[model samples]
Structures are given as C-alpha cells and as structure tokens.
Target: MATEITTAPHDGSTDPASPARLCGRLLGRVETRLHDFLAAERELRTRVDARAAAPIDALTALIDSGGKRIRPAFCVAGYLAAGGDPASEDIVAAASALEMLHTCALIHDDVIDASPRRRGLPTVHARHSAEHARNGWEGEPRRYGESVAILAGDLALIYADQMMSEASPSLGAAWAELRSELIIGQFMDVVVAAEFSADVALSRWIAVVKSGRYTIHRPLLIGATLAGRPELEGAFEAYGDALGEAFQLRDDLMDAFGDSDATGKPVGLDIEQHKMTLLMGLAMDRDRRTREFVLGAERDPAEVRRLLDETGVRMDVEAHIDRLVEKGRAAIDAAPLDERWQRELGAMAHQVAYRNS
Candidate 1:
C-alpha cells in the first residue's frame, strides 16, 4: 500500500528541478498533508468516542514509517496536471482515500503474508503478536496474533471506505472497481504461489491486477476523474500501466537486494513466502534448471541465490527490470502531461528503477 520507494537522504548534488528533487519535494508535501489529515481524523475520533481510535494509536507509526506517499502524490500531481484544482477538498479527499486504501491493503497484505516487519519496525501482526504473548490472556498465541491483525486490517479498510465516501459519491463506482481488482490481484498471487496458475500469461494478469491497476491505473484514473479530464483518460491509463509495471519491477528488485532495515520487511521474502512475482516468473520462464530450482526451493536464502546464479535467473530478472524501466520512460514520454508533471514522472521512473529499498 505504501508503494515502497527507495531513496537516499539529500546529498545536495541534484538541482531543485531534478526528478529526485521533485520526488523529495512532493514527498515532503505529502507528509505534511498526511499529518494534517491524520490530525483531523483524530479530532473526528475524539468526537465519535468509538473503538475505532484503538487502531489510531499505531496508525501514525505505520503511516510515518511508509517508504513514500508516491501514489497519493501522483494522484494529486496527475489531477493538477490535468488542470484540476489542488485546493479542491474533494480532490484532496480522493488522494487521502487512496492512501487509506493503500494502507488497508498493506495491513491485510502483511497479515496474509505473515510478514514480521515493515518499514524497519515490527509489522502490525508482529506488534500484536508480541503484545498478545506478553499479556498471556488467551488461547493459541498465533491465533491471537493473527486475529488481532485481521481486526486491525479490517478497521483500516472500514476507515478507508469512510474516507472514500466522504470524497464524493461520484468516485464510488470507480473506487469499487479498483477495490475488486486489488482483491483479484491478491487472490491470484496466492493461487499462483500454490501452483494453480504458473503460466506466463497468468503472471502477466497478476501484474495487471496487482501492480497495474492497484497502484498505477486506478490512482491515475481517480485523479483524472476528479480533474474532469475525460478526453485524456486513455493517456493517463497508458501512463499508469507503464508506471505500475516499473513500480513492480522495483519491488522485485528490492525483494532480492533491498535492505531489510529499510523495507521494514525481511529480504528474500518473496522466495521465502513463495509469492509468484514477475521476477520469479521470468526466472522460471527462462530455463528448465531455473524452474526446477525455484519449484523445489526451500526457505533458505543461500540456496535460492545459488539457484538463481546457476540458472542466470537473477541476471535475467534484472534485465527485465531494465526493460520495464525503459518502457515506463517511453510511456511517460508519450503521455500528454504538463512539463512540470512530466519532469516529475520521469524522475520517478528513475527512482523506481534504481531504488535500493
């Protein structure tokens, strides 16, 4: 949900108008805006005096630990590029809703994946699991842990829906479609991991649903919709596809080579969890040895790396990542974006490709 991006702290080497600069500037703006939004939500919670505030305690931690608010910033950027008002409460609401939706997805995703960490801290499940054990107030410890996390994720989704509803019912139908695609994507990821659909076509479908629509297309579509730029919707959709693919490529790269401390999750998690990412698919698709290695793999990272090395799987996957980067840049180039947004988009493409997290 955080649409994880990897970037180093400011080194003062890049110009302010550079893509890195734009990304940093935009991220700063998002952080500031998110704080305001969370404060408002907290104020609302105080008035409601409901159990919903329980999740609010860790909410800021989770949000603040996020890699970057790339999706929400893109939504706002796209909206503005399409001649939309950045000051529109509805537009801001829509961007905020997307962020919430992404958070909900990540909460559920971490639970489903049984991930122990995120953004360099204990994942929600891990936090709750530890708490459950410390309190020693229940049945099976794992069950308690999973149950609390499930409830937390559910709460996030509920709050996200509430936020979306406040964004204007005009976005309801589109939001529903986006939500459905996300579910379908998650399901496909699970099924593929179980060896249900190990084909290349199926992997592509998963890419479209998981990364394409969820992160790229849907967010941009919502932005354009709010901007009322109906004519250029197709262009935005195309841009989203490329950007989303680029985003996923980076995800695959980070999964393999990222800093566990930075990503807030363990490295080699995809291999450990057996999630069917496009990188894994490319590895398998390349040769018979790669297929055997991946399929018969254990949870051992060294073994996985060895297999990847022997079959050139890692190299092949890395090559595909480069290709995706080029494709994303080309798509952005083709898109009808304003100069400012175009520069930002190009810079993001670089970050997506080269990110170490």
Candidate 2:
C-alpha cells in the first residue's frame, strides 16, 4: 500500500548523517532509481516491442504519482540499522525493487477491486479500459482493460525480480518467499470474500500472511539479510509483525469510513465487497446485527454503516490497533538496533498506525 507522510523539521543539528535527514532523503534515491530504470526500460520496450510501452508507461506513471515511500524506507532503515552502506548500489537497487514489487501488487489489487480511482487518478485498468473505449475497440472494454492490467502487473513483477537480481544471494530466498506469500495471500483473500467465511482464525491468518508478512516483516528481513545480520532476524520479525497488523487494521478502517479524496479509494469497499476482516469476525461472534449489516451493505451502504456504528465494532477495532502498536513499540525497545534507528522506527510505527492514507 502507498502512504503519504507529513514531515516536520527535527529539533537537533542539521548534520548530514542524522536520522532526522534519512527518512525523506533516502526516498530521493528511490525515486531517482525508479525513474532512471523505467526510462531505460521504456526505451528498451519501444525498440523490442513498441506497443508494449503503453503498459510500461502506466507503471511509470503510477510510480510518479505521490506515495509515502514506506516500503523502500523500511528497506533502507533495515540496511542502515544493520550497518549496511546505504550509498552502495546493492541496497539502492534492492530498495527500488521493493517499490516495484509493490507496484505489481497494487496493479493486481486494483484489478481485483475493479477500482476506478487510485491516488486521485484512474487506476491502470481503468485508464486502459477508457482508452479501449475511446479507440472503439471490437471487444468488451472491461475485459480488454483487465487483461492489459494483468500483463502490466506481470511485467512489473518481472522488472522487480530483474532489479533485485543484482543483490546478494542471501536476499534471493526472502524475495522468493515474499512473492509466494503475495500470491497465496491474494488467493486466500478471494476465498474468504467468496465464501463470506467468518472463521476468526482464518481472518487473523489472512491478515498475518497477507499484510503482516508481505508488507513489513519480509522487507525487514530482506534489509537485514542484505547487511548480513542474521542475529537481528527474530527482532525484525517481532517489530514487523505488530506494525504490519496495525497497518492492515488501519487500512480496513479507512476502507470502511474514510473520505474518497483522503483514502484514494471508495468508502465502504470492505462492506461492498463483503471482505472478511478480523473486526468482522469479532463482530459476528458478538451479535447478529453485524452480519445483517454486512449482507445489506451492498444494497444500502448508509444504513449498514449506521448499523455498524451502533454495533460499536469500530471502537473495538480502534482499541485493538492501539494494543498492536504498543506491542510493536515494546519489540522495538528490546531490539538490537542503534539509537538512531530506534528513534526512526519508533516514529515510523506511529506513522504506520495513524496515517490518513
């Protein structure tokens, strides 16, 4: 998922090596690498298969769109925390690759969501679908659009793998694991939604495997592996697991009630899609209204939202998020990171949980 961070100047010195400067500064490298790589790839695709440049353009445009750079930042943070050279080509390439993989996921996700808008603009599929319509294509606009988007996502995954291939072999295993988890998570998500399964354990497992492991935990491990710091593995997982849970919990909340402009997604999507979440699982166990509301949300979302409000699951979820964030904080406190990363990651945790998008 993409995020938008709000920055404030640090109180201390304006030293070049300060943690205060690292967060947004490292993102500059990521953006530059992404731009340069995509430009080269665009030229290469144009020469080899000119028509293929369209999807590449879509991917590049999406990257150019605004983002908080959370995943790449986490990779950099882990590398720095492990004393890896941030200026080294390996780390920069790996970090950029993480963002590419994220792009791939979002493309596929937008296809799954059939979402029209992302980051306040047309999603890759929607953009292509509109183009198909404008061209007076001879087939269904949506099918043509979605098929192109799948190819774009596949191409993105290929580019991500190509970018990270330059990194150390140790990083390769984590990369494979991450891709596998992503596929499995998507599969599980579909099953849960299709069946409307309220099994609490299944819901939690989906959260852990999908968002928790894929987003935060593996990235942390990937960073540490790049630095050759195997000792930090347990600590990385601990910190990542909690933060990842908080991240998804917040995502679900945003899907339920956030402004379309603020979230870059339609409000009440979870209800509209009937996606299973832990909050839904808990609410189901407590009363019948939650189930009724979820079932009715597709037809009359406002009433379902009202029913949801009366059920009080929203407040319960808020408290649960607080608890998970605290666990993440405690893990960070006990981790073998330096003072600089300790402060940086602590601040990052709050950003992950409390972010508006």
Best by TM-score: 2
Model 2's alpha-carbon lDDT is 0.80
lDDT tens readout by residue for model 2, 25-123: 666777889999999989987986789799899899899887776778778777778887757778888888988999999999999988898888899
| RMSD in angstroms between candidate 1 and the native structure over all alpha carbons | 3.7
lDDT tens readout by residue for model 1, 244-335: 76678678767876777776678888877777787777767777766676676344666766777777776776676677667766776777
Q: Give the Å shift of residue 128 in candidate 1.
A: 1.3
Off by over 4 Å in 1: 1-52, 297-300
lDDT of 1: 0.70
lDDT of each: 0.70, 0.80
